[model samples]
Target: MTPPDSQLPLGRRGLLAALGAAGLSASARPAPAAQRRLPLTAQTTEGPYYLDLALDRRDITEGLEGVPLDVRFTVCDTAGRPLPKLRVDLWHCDMQGRYSGFGEQGDDRAQSFEGKTFLRGSQRTDRAGIVSFGTVYPGWYAGRTTHIHFKVINGARAVLTSQFFLPDALSEFLYTQMPLYQRARMRDTLNSVDGIALKAGGTVLGAVREERQRYVATLALVVDPAAVPVIDRPPRPGGLPPGGPFPGSTPLSGARPPRPRALEGSARIRAMVPPRAEG
Candidate 1:
């Protein structure tokens, strides 16, 4: 089943503002990012560097095609329920952690969200395994701390990879005299957190269930029906890698999608399908 790459680009436009989670109105082009290039550095935490651009047909420059990401949460399964199509893998950095790829310096296209990568992607979980993304609201990234990393593969590999924070009671009333967050709060500090909870050890849970612009939570994984870990691994970031997902389908990304738009609005961008069901 190793067959899905075509180079993966066609038309060129809809990146929902380089996927920092995309939230705009009052005017579509507002995402012009006001000429961007604002606060740009790195090392910040709160992890999960988001940038793939929701379900991504690569988007239509902003008309926002499928238009998902109104937002929702939870994907329990330790004793809970729903684990249906499990495959979440978000990425973050942008509220300032200045991430886009490699070390990130001038002209990756010219930064801002540069050609925008590192915000990573992937999302599945329906039939009840729910999932959400239409992101935006991440904005303070100078040198770390804000968090949102997640994992729940269930099919080929990775069964969990936690980290979801914000709300140390506002960093203990504005980081009391420092000392590593002094007395800590946000659901009892990481006890000893560093470099983003050490790449998320012990399933982090600092706090903050819901904040404005957007941020929600709920995650739990424990899969080990007996001993499930074969992982031939291969079909990711490209297409159909490990070969496990096949309920309704749609995950094998080696490449292909990016061809149809011959005259949707003329400007170009096509490859839209689905129109049969005859009788």
Candidate 2:
């Protein structure tokens, strides 16, 4: 059996290197992004489960519980200025690897996880270009590793649509130790093996760690709202009704995700990791 990429464990130093190699971590102190040239967040497929639910809240758990995680995103522009009033939306599966509100699952849309709306919600960023969510650690499934999907929008315009990943070690611990998540068997995929992660150059992996009593994950997204290409595929901006596309929308295609520019230098960003478990 092949080893998982997360199994190789990254300390603060190593994490910084990865982020640097990906052109994500530019500085520890605040400086003009133009001077530092912050990289833009990479875009990924919205997948088949994306919905236009009219939800606006911080807690998307809908009552399921596992390891508590407070996910936050700092939305900024190339100038390092906060992008106030933009909306950030996130959705993920429960511990059982089952997503909500989908009657058909997977690419073929042959399975059902319908009648559920658990881990799906949107929160508008505050004046400081930050949006936070109260959710739990995601579990693994057959095809994909543990991850969370998110989108950033300024009114009707989509700024970025991407996913974030959890480290393999922590994901393994959750399934092997947590009763609720253990029900779904972990798969063989790793961050090193996930096509989207590879194509996005590791920027999709969130900087994560346990903070006090809960796990905290953060991602710094520098986006040029003016430059982000519009997504015209149906289920268009104002979002579609629950279980939408209303029949004439473009069909979800199996195309590859767009690849952004490669990292040009070797600068490093500090790493963040969860605290060690209590003995």
Candidate 3:
């Protein structure tokens, strides 16, 4: 059997030639830098809204209306080796900037969406450490820019909790031009001013491209599987921690964020693991 590209002993030029002969371009060859230990993916606050519903499915839109978006994530270790069998949970607000299963979100207090689940789901990585979701472009809310939240889990422990940001220009265009996103006024915060975005740096920005009918956004997550999990402490009363809820906005009501639920057992774990295969 032929060895995998990573196992090949070809030099740079030889690797390029091998890729070309295999009908792949030079870009297909893994860069030499990728062979080194990559920096751990930056960690960010898990804002007030996060629920581990264990809904394992690809399409998370659940009929919510907005510009279609296909979000993809690649998970690998700090040494750049793909890590399969890890659960990735993604959740974002709807076009109206309201998260499912949460009654109160950014100035809306009387609304009740309890027991509702949309724009949220979990999927495990395949052999190549890739997972994809079918959803809509996330809407913006006060105090924060347009973004999506995700968590990487091994067993019951969450190794990383971070958010993905879209380009400000693209977000602005969608808010102003798209009818579905026009319900709200322009987003008050942008990537530049967003405290979390600024702290997380440019690494959180996903590479997005326009497809025929939807937008595709992709991000790479490099984590240290053995690293200690960061504890998510609740923000101060009546507001988020530093760089949290935009200034002058209604302070978030003092409610403890929901704690993540545990996966069932070995059965649940097995369901999250994709069948092993080589790329």
Candidate 4:
């Protein structure tokens, strides 16, 4: 019962002609760089928690100490591939940004938000699929900058939600002390180039840092129906019933396609297309 990330069966007029076939004019402009690799949603969406809390907070799975963060992001595919089982649902804004509620609260239904259900717990995609969360670093609320609001489910029609910032130790400490967060700089933003909607973009944020600080990174998600199928079909430990012959099963001879490891770079995030426009 999970298949909505981008909900692409190619319906709804094929996602509005892939979000309008694009041309580039939101502002920044230089995308056309998805030469080969695929699978990136370039996600983002937690603006100071978007302030919708009336009451709903279990201390958010106990995360609000002060940068105690253990951030880990991994949902790549735009050449920098890495998407295992995919099911990362996160919620943010507590260091002081606010956001600590969802709806119909009763048992707090895990800090309801009606979506991304995770006051602090919804990470999968391991075994190299990548998806780790032990968050903390989230505080600048008012105007906006240091962010975190995810929803990358590869099985439940949320496609590639968004929100993920922190690139350059607040941009070299705000270019020195504080200069409007240096316009959320990351090598001159624009999602890399006037990102209205993948006019021809692909670089699903490789990683975002506070100083290559390693606060945590692995966010390289780009999605829009072009290609999102990293199927290794993992999850076969102890026993086997898919066709008999367990134990690393495979004797009928035909089924060998799971090899792509050894990635240790960290640093790259370019997912900005959400000011509020999703037809």
Q: Name the candidate that leads on lDDT.
A: 3
Task: For candidate 1, write residues 203-261 as lDDT tens digits.
Answer: 34322333432233333333432333443332222122111232123444454322111
Between candidates 1 and 4, the one scoring higher on lDDT is: 4
Candidate 2, residues 195-229, lDDT tens digits: the string is 66557764666766656556778888778877667
Give residue 42's lDDT in candidate 3 (0 to 100).
79
lDDT for each residue of candidate 4 in 83-129, tens digit (9 for 90 to 100): 57666667665443334543322212223444533345566677666
Which regions of candidate 3 deviate over 4 angstroms? 1-35, 106-108, 233-244, 247-279
Minimum summed lDDT over a 10-residue window in model 4 is located at: 21-30
* TM-score for each predicted model, relative to the true structure: 0.24, 0.70, 0.73, 0.24
Candidate 4 lDDT = 0.40
The CA lDDT at 171 in model 3 is: 60
Alpha-carbon lDDT of model 2: 0.63
Which of the two, 1 or 3, has more lDDT? 3
By TM-score, the best candidate is: 3
Clashes of 1: 42
Candidate 2, superposed: residue stretches over 4 Å from native: 1-34, 104-111, 228-279
